[model samples]
Target: MNSTRRDFTELTMMSKEKWNDEELFYFQHALSQLLQYVNPEGLSILHEINREMHSRD
Candidate 1:
């Protein structure tokens, strides 16, 4: 999967354990919308986090 998708998958997995189904759904939906306008710096940060998460896997 792409890094972004992978990172999101990892996040969803973690959130599933911590949040109720409805809460998790809204959290992911909000994040998905927020990501659409992320600045270059923010995108880089997310890429870095994705890399870190991938390395752990």
Candidate 2:
């Protein structure tokens, strides 16, 4: 993975245990908003985050 994805994944893992349902929901919503304005690389990161979050459900 690129540095962006690697850094994001690391951050997510570090915070994973601390996220409550509401926080996760808010994060997803924020990512969705960001997606609208980001480039393809950013979109990929958002998608990865979404997939990771969903897999936790």
Candidate 3:
């Protein structure tokens, strides 16, 4: 058997999409820059995950 978990940050982003457009937009823009500063690979993975999540909606 295998188990998987979502990180706290991922969960937070998922919930943020429920907010109004401007709020969500700012949240995303901030996260994008922060992710780049933290790690380029992290930003790549984050963008990929974001695409998958949004595609489902």
Candidate 4:
């Protein structure tokens, strides 16, 4: 897991625009399950995944 904002940003940027449909669907489902218990960082990751998913629309 990324310990700092910079690393998290780097990871997010690296992963953005890279998820295929199946991967995005998997992440969306997994993150939705984590939504109830996720920390703020997890929320951010989930948000990014959702953003990518929506971008496909």
Residue 50 CA displacement from its true place in model 3, Å: 0.5
Q: At residue 29, give the lDDT of candidate 2.
A: 80
TM-scores for every candidate against the unseen true structure = 0.42, 0.49, 0.38, 0.67
Candidate 1 per-residue lDDT over residues 1-57, each given as its tens digit:
223233444553453344334444444455457798877855654555444444545
* Highest TM-score scorer: 4
- List, residue by residue over 1-57, the lDDT tens digit for candidate 3: 114544446655565344444444444576677874757756665565466457656
Off by over 4 Å in 2: 1-26
| Residue 24, model 2: Cα distance from true site in angstroms | 5.2
Q: Which stretches of candidate 4 lie over 4 Å from their true place?
A: 1-13
Q: What's the residue-level lDDT of 2 in candidate 2? A: 25
Clashing pairs in model 4, backbone N/Cα/C closer than 3 A: none
Residue 35, candidate 4: Cα error in Å is: 1.1
- What tens-digit string does per-residue lDDT give for candidate 2 at 4-56? 23334455665544555555565568778876787786676567657667878
lDDT (Cα atoms) of all candidates against the true structure: 0.50, 0.61, 0.54, 0.70
- The lDDT-based order of candidates, best leading, equals 4, 2, 3, 1
TM-score result, candidate 3: 0.38
Clashes of each: 0, 0, 0, 0
